[model samples]
Target: MKILLIKAARLKSSASRRHDGVMPPLGFLYLSAALKKAGYTDITLLHLALEGMGREGLERELERLKPDVVGISAMTSEAVSMHMAAACAKNGRNPLVVAGGAHPTAYVSDCLEDPNIDAVVRNEGEITFPELLAAYGRKAGFEGIKGVSYRSGGRRTDNPPREFIEDLDTLPLPDWDLAEMGRYKDFVPHSPMLYGRRYMSVFTSRGCPYRCTYCHSIFGKRFRAHSPERVLRELRILKEKYGVSNVEISDDVFNLDRARAAAVMNGVISGGLNLNIFFGNGLRAELLDEELIELFSRAGVKYVCAAIETASLRLREKIKKNADLEKLRAAVKLLVRRRIFVNGFVMMGFPDETVKEMLVTARYLWSLPIHSFLLFFCRGYAGAEMCGTLPPARRIDPKTDNTCFVPGGGCSSQPAWKLLAVKQLTTAVFYFLNPARIFRIFRDLPFRDARLFWFLFRTMSVKFFSPARR
Candidate 1:
């Protein structure tokens, strides 16, 4: 049987390209590997955003491929796009249309409500997706299939929850060969620090034990990681076969397991693979120590980001961040001393949080040794604990309504204009207090590559200035 997997574009127009760079869809790649391992060799992958395809182009491709099954991977922000793609793919053919990803995992009923979608896959798809395909191939009843929600006899039926995969070592390496790797290399996200080398993203672990209110959708609290040996083998494959000189570790918490993290770093160092490594996903600052810092520096880690959501201790505790300010400061200092670039990930507009409290975070950031920072308005995405407090209208489409520009919907007591002004003020203060940070950006960025520099500048500007206002 032929299978087609599509990574839906996040937004409707070309504007989505500004946000989604050459970041390959790692989730679909893993699913492809699982399908291949299950003896389903006829599989095709399509990334709409990377291919610059619109609805018409999508329909053209769907008609040409004519797969028996089409799976769409999407995030919460891509709900509309997913529906459009599904409708187009099922225009003339009767292929089974399935939706999976963070959005579907959190809002399965929302996906099943759409006429274009036949089923929604919840949680991890590596094991569940293969089982689902096999059941479809055999024409067997899906009543007993775990981790799936579908419409049955005009009623929605959700099966029992599936258990998480504990042994991550058994999973096959991601099928990068199925994707157009050359096209992705030119448009990789976070290219400034990458030094214009071919880069690939790898996940050595899944799940985070922390209770950060904003991050409860995709991966739950259970912490699972691949063994160091397995991680080394994948790295070797990337280096030898793909000629990947840079790797972006996409783990939620890279240093959660100190011993395992150290083992992976030591393995990279001992293997003589002088690859540039980056942790663009924020890591816990409190988990870092001198030993880990040294290991990272020795392993050629050039970029690190810490998730310091808020600087206000009261707000931090209220949100269950549990990050120690002292430890975070020390960690930033260590990375800076080692010449590793550091960035702080911060947020504003929490429920019942005042402008004063938000400014306190900006002030704290000003006092740190971090080279730069990203300020974001809190988004009460579905499946988050805070989403329970939101009104029905606000919860309808969080992609556009969960920003500072949305009045009273993003959990801010202030008016939309006021909240936006405060956000602008906080960003101005953070950068104004540190002129050296501007010079640092120039020094670190690859200014020689005008194309890359412009791309980074345009993306950053859009994110900073454009509020997701409906």
Candidate 2:
């Protein structure tokens, strides 16, 4: 079967790429590899953002390729483009359009409701997607396929959830040949600031054991990871086959298994990959120690982004984001001592949270021994435990809501606008009050990524000088 997989872009316009940076669509690459392994020879991968393709461009491609099946993956932010691309595929073509990725997995009914989308391959698609093709090839319906939700006679049938993949190493490496790696070399979705020109992202693991209420359950709570040996092999390919010098380890919980994490680092050093690495996905701060920090540095880890959701202990409990604040502090100190740049993720405006708690969180984040940090206004999604517990009035708007919802203060005591203003000013307070941090941020550039400095400056300036508050 002729199959076309598209990494649907989430953007207001191609010109404004700040929200969705030029990520290489690692998910689609893996899907392509999976299809190839299933003995599918006629497969094509399209990345709309990287190609600067809109409806017109897509129309031309659809006419030219005339694919039998079109699969589109989209995050919550990319819902608009996801449906749009599906509609494009349906126009004048009898191709089956399948939707996958974070948005579809969480909102299966909505995806299948659309006439453009024939089905949804929920959660992990590496195995299920190929099996789906096999069943379809035999002219069998999707009724028996686990993890598939499809439309049947005006009703949606969602099959039982698929079991998680046990051995990650069995899956082949992503099909980098299918992607426009040259375009991705110019912009990075994670770790925008890097050391070298040729850079890429690598996922060493899947799933998280922690049940952070605000996180997606796509990977499930069971932690599955590529063995350290398998990880080293992937790195060697990036270095040898693709000439990728700088790498972003973008695992959701990379350091979840401390011993395994260390083994991966040790292998990187012994393998002589010499790749400058950054922990773009936030690591659990409490898990790190002096020894692990040293190993990370030795493995060429120049930057770390820790996920410290809230500094307020009360808020942390409310959100179920358990962490040892003291241990996190020590980890930051150790990373700093190792000359590794550090960034943190902090959230504000949880349900029933007081303004004082936000100020405390901001002050704690500012006082941290790190170069930079990101302050987010907390929002919940349809599948998150927090939202499920909220009262009817406070329930998530499934059509318009996801983790990246617009800051509505989220059932908090304060107004959304006030909370946003405070959030922006909280950042201003961190930099403007401590003039030394500006210099420290510049000095702490491990990759000498000037883009980092410029990003900080632009944000601080807008918060301080912009008349309209965020």
Off by over 4 Å in 1: 12-16, 188-192, 396-409, 443-448, 455-470
| TM-score attained by model 1 | 0.93
Tens-digit lDDT string for candidate 2 (131-203): 8999888888888799999998998888999999899999999998887676775554567565225677888
In candidate 1, what are the lDDT values of residues 229-283, reduced to their tens digit?
9999999999999988788888888789899999999999999988888888837
Model 2 pairs whose backbones collide: none
For each candidate, the alpha-carbon lDDT, in order, equals 0.78, 0.79
Estimate the TM-score of every prediction: 0.93, 0.94
Listing every candidate in turn, what is its Cα RMSD in Å to the true structure after a full C-alpha superposition?
2.4, 2.4
